[model samples]
Target chain A: MSEVIVITSGKGGVGKTTTTANVGTGLAQLNKKVVLIDTDIGLRNLDVVMGLENRIVYNLVDVVEGNCRMKQALIKDKRYPNLSLLPSAQTRDKTAVSPEQMIKVIEELKEEYDYILLDCPAGIEQGFKNAIAGADRALVVTTPEVSAIRDADRIIGLLGANELKKVELIVNRLRMDMVKRGDMMNINDVTDILAIDLIGAVPDDEQIVISTNQGEPLVGSDCLAGKAFENICHRILGEDVPFLDLEIKTSIWDKIKEIFKKN
Target chain B: MSLMDLFKKKNSGDIAKDRLKLVLISDRANCSPDVMEMIKNDIIQVISKYMEIDAEGLDIQITQTESEGNNGNVPALYANIPIKDMKHTGPAR
Candidate 1:
């Protein structure tokens, strides 16, 4: 059976969709059969983010409504043959499908895939509840900002309230330079506030935006953020990989060396 | 006073007592810094009920000592509400 993982954040625009896309692609890159389901109905953006928007003929609504078979709605990725996506209905609302319906859908898909990734919507409303109904574990994504960290902490509390045990943290958009200057909160500060195990820390990289815009996830060793995503995938598979701190280090030796070389 | 006498300032018990007194007052009056500022303004308004209030020099602050352990803990809030000179001395004034 596949392990259903939900990537969620209570606060909006905190890289939930990006983390979902990259992590799903990372798992697939590891030769695991993975399927990503976007549950943000009506305001669906995952398909567009994944560059699979044009290919979404039938979506989650069709499968739930019994208009089409589940296998028919699944869109196989051209880059990774083992990876697929089940896009949400762009015209329907969150109430279009019930939690039980999502659970049944995942239950059926579990037999064929090794991992089922759900890109959850923001806020602690029905959308959030429906997204995690069928998941085995949750990857709570949050940025380093105080508000985002507070919201993530609240969401973790809610997940604990829901009896969800396996909850991990992913700190995204971290600026190591700002952290060194004491201008932004570092990973330790965030972890201290939220009191959760850290699984991945993705630095703020311009390449991520370019890659995201290009509809190609950065997961290779060549891309810093991609390697971070791959490391997260490895951790998810029960591998203990040491986390890499992406913050820049400016030591006196390097500064002196730069001055001497310039002179 | 000897060097020890100079160090013989208030002990932990005394400090804790002071802190407890202030904390109790603040807790009862539900007074915070923000609330205290509003209260200071209200005090000025009420003092303007009878006498003039020096708003420029007026100061209101709450101080509290936070300590750990039962042996010696100084925890208290000290509020200093200082009002400047006014013409009024008595109720009649």
Candidate 2:
């Protein structure tokens, strides 16, 4: 069965596009036909992130407006034959595509692909509404920060109000060292407040920056974030994959306690 | 700083969690703390018109609680208004 999932974060720059690209690629690597749609119309980046910016002959606006066939607009990734991208137009704004149009586009893709991942634009505006219109499930990506968590909570309420009940969370950019030091919010702290099923927790890794800059999905790399994304893909496919171990090493306090016990 | 002070200093994670707890409750209720206070006062005024109520012991809060069955957590408005005695047994004031 095909699943239309919208990857959204109420706030921008929280790795929505990166998550969409990596997860879609991960699914494709797992032999599933996947299409990643960039719904951030005016500020299109998914195409660039996927390194398909040069081959975009048609975009989402073109398909929705009936200016081009859906197949013609889909950019196939040479790396993963099963993976494709529907890039958004840079000239048009969010209002260019309505929710009904998005549903129509998604429905058509649903028949051809095993998974349809929509990279929703930031905020709960027209863009966000359009992204979630035809989605059967939502993957809310958030960082371990106060502002991001607050916005994510708002988005969760909005999704519930819209009747998108199959919502899960992805805690992105978690720094284990900072979490150990109590400087960053841990996974439990985030999930407790969000109160959604956690599908993945990706630690903050510098390798993600390198992979993203190279227009490669981190899932194929040996980086920690890449492994986490792959595990999330497996979990999405109904496999009972264990979460990545992000525990920090024993702290000085714990070491001192161990010494006292040995005395 | 003392070792105790270091432990006592609220970490950013705890601070974020506490702030999110408060904000999420208010956001779900679609009312601010001040608005909740106003609503509590209004409820008290209406109830106290006919009954001797323990206004001091009244409590009104927007809390998060899990729904019955497989449903997830939901925001709920809980009001605890204690009634001391009936001020008027008549039908109307």
Query: Which candidate tops DockQ?
Result: 2
lDDT of 1 by residue, A29-108 (tens): 99999999999988888887888888988999999999999989999999999899999998889999888999999999
How much does candidate 1 score in TM-score?
Answer: 0.73
Model 2: chain B TM-score relative to the native chain B: 0.59
Can you give the DockQ of every candidate in the order shown?
0.04, 0.65
Report clash pairs, candidate 2. Answer: none
| lDDT for each residue of candidate 2 in A111-210, tens digit (9 for 90 to 100) | 9899999999999999999999999999999999888998998999999999999999999999898898888889998998888999999988898898
Clashes of each: 6, 0
Please name the candidate that would achieve the greatest lDDT relative to the true structure. 2
Candidate 1 docking band: incorrect
Return the number of clashes found in candidate 1.
Answer: 6
